[model samples]
Target: MHDSHSERMSGSETRAASGLALVFAFRMLGMFMVLPVLATYGQDLAGATPALIGLAIGAYGLTQAVLQIPFGIISDRIGRLPVIYIGLLIFAAGAALAANADSIWGVIAGRVLQGAGAISAAVMALLSDLTREQHRTKAMAMIGMSIGVSFAVAMVVGPLLTRAFGLSGLFWATAIMALLGIVIVAAMVPRASHPLQHRESGVARQALLPTLKHPDLLRLDFGILALHAILMASFVALPLALVEKAGLPKEEHWWVYLTALLVGFFGMVPFIIYGEKKRQMKKVLVGAVAVLFLCELFFWQFGNSLRALVFGTILFFTAFNLLEASLPSLISKVAPAGGKGTAMGVYSTSQFLGAALGGILGGWLYQHGGLSTVFVGCAVVCAIWLAIAVTMREPPYVTSLRLPLSAAAVADTGLVTRMLAMPGVADAVVVAEEAAIYIKVDSEKLDRTSLESLIESAPERAEA
Candidate 1:
């Protein structure tokens, strides 16, 4: 809400955000590549019974969900870069293990270790620290954009790489890319020692409950989980259906993926513009979810036809992109401004867990219930998530103001309480060590000079 010039991204913050984006994209891109081919590839591996194979495929997600928050908390206490470096190193080890696995168990072990490096939460926290509160959203948007780009690229290239070098080669390539990412992070990011008093490294103990209690926030979180679940499940079924029902060759699936990604990307622009520029985020979000629901229904009935699969897949992705971009923006608009980073952490965890559940459940359903059941199950999940989202209240935009305080001023709880009552102030948190007061307020109401006047007279400081 506040247009204070403080929100502008400084040059250093921009470069730091860019580096963080590369880390997120590189890590995610590798994981996504397996989605397109896992079910098919698993069938050919020697020790992969159908049941065990799904476990192997989905294991990475479970580990990632379990570790992300802890990893983030560790970064807060230990240093973001160090934690990140450890994660990348673990990821590289996992990659090499998976690359050389002769049995399904070995692949599963690799996946579990890979999940252990879960650095996404840490990466996000670092971005927040690097930029001013005013520029936080833009910095976050860049991260979101990077993830979208990575997923798109992975989808397009996966099948081609599978054809060119086989699945093992994909793992090897990801390993190499991760090591390269480690080099980038260590060499490019600033490495000054942070005083323990000046920075937080570990996970916040209070993250989950507050995030879960907010109805609007909960709705968005549920939607993300459902959205990613649908994505994971559909890929499980789509490629096999394409080859078996539609008579497309396996290698040529890339042709379809490339076409759909390119087109779906362009198709999402109008909805994004409408949501942001026209203030129609809710309307657009609902419409996209509705479209995706119908696409699932259509796929259930007609996915056997190549043309029908192509049309349905394209529609699914277009709606997915629209919802994905819109949801995080909506979260920023709605979250209690003081707790945005925490909210995102919870949201990210739910999504990774949902993807894990989807892979296992979808695989089992495919093995037992066949095509009709798998499609029906995912459609029902989407329909329920849609109902939950439609009932949420829309949120107003928020802006934060930060006031630098003297070390002595940081100890005055009474002074901090008084500032919370100021006109337009909604929430306040004072970090004494940094002499910074993070305040949420109506974006339209920032009066910097008056706010500074208040800060100058804080109880611990002499009124000047």
Candidate 2:
């Protein structure tokens, strides 16, 4: 009857999306605020060793990677709100523990506990529960933007907070943020009247095997893992380099990050536009990885000068942000129809594991071979990723849609055949139990008016 995609988000839908985005932002802000300052101040803890400090930096990722999916599955059984409350409380407690800890081991324990909260999947599931299928993509995109902003803000804020309040105070602030997230959940977030498992939003058990075995998806996963490994490892040395080589003081570090992040954020926009608009995503991705390789090399060779540190940091983030933004979009493109959530779940887990690996790699290399060694190690990792990324097939530029279907449509045995026969319909899945259809379509080629007309026209019912 009407263009299904044309519907705007209702007031309730808008509220739900915005509130959940805030919750996501709060949690991530807490997780990331430590990245910039940890290396400089972490050494003050009792019995702190470089390796152990690295562990402290990455400990949360280990637990987060393990528990992320389990938390979502658990929410499916117990309900979304309860799981969110519990996650926030656990996160707060962990932050408090770290704030009070005196030894490196204790801080590591705190970080592990912090990661154990693992509520990202749960939050996304909740968002899915609250939004209409037509608006779900937009809702999810809002959450994604919030995360990117949170990371940028954290990088700038971390140094400022650490300098003003010290390490313990920084942890305490994260604890407060977690507690605040609980308040937002209770006071602001709307309750989902019915929570359904969405193949596009929540991980599907049946979809996991195929998603994991997907060669291109697997390559992308490795790419994220390598990307984060470089991030953690680089951060482990970056602060030290700034202080020792650039002769910058610890308190002034925020200025460098703020400026670099600002430059990086703006610098990547043209590349993103070129990639998406020009349909040269593979070229952009490969080129970004290559830039990453060179940036690491620059850091290893000439990072001792102040200008090099600043310029190199700016270049590094430009490439880093581009890849970070590109990888998820690529995952969406590469994943099978109806398996986006599962593919993303696996990709996220790989990312966390990489964070853990990078921390340890950075620490050991820095300790044994000095600051340059960390860059060397990160350069090698980027080199490997560059090699792998070059072989990726050109992605199909398509938009994914999950639409609620009428019972008659669900019962129509030939519904998929009819849709697939459409000019721009790339893939379709009729999941009867979920009372919905998942589709991938080339936006440029798809005639939305005709497609909707066919869907509403009539269904060829299966023979009873």
The best candidate by TM-score is 2
In model 1, what is the error at residue 302, expressed in angstroms? 1.5
User: Candidate 1, residues 261-375: lDDT per residue as tens digits?
Assistant: 8888999998889777666778888898889889889989988889999998889889988888888777666766346667777777888888887777777778787766778
What's the lDDT for residue 262 in model 2? Answer: 93
Worst 10-residue lDDT window, candidate 2? 455-464
Tell me each candidate's RMSD, in Å, in order: 3.4, 1.5
Query: Where in model 1 is the C-alpha error above 4 Å?
Result: 1-11, 49-53, 192-203, 406-426, 431-434, 444-464
Estimate the overall C-alpha local distance difference test score of candidate 2.
0.90
Residue ranges of candidate 2 with Cα displaced over 4 Å: 1-6, 458-464
lDDT of 1 at 461: 55
Question: Quick one: best lDDT, which candidate?
Answer: 2
lDDT for each candidate structure: 0.77, 0.90
TM-score of each predicted structure versus truth: 0.89, 0.97
Q: RMSD, model 1, all Cα superposed?
A: 3.4
- Cα lDDT for residue 397, model 2? 95
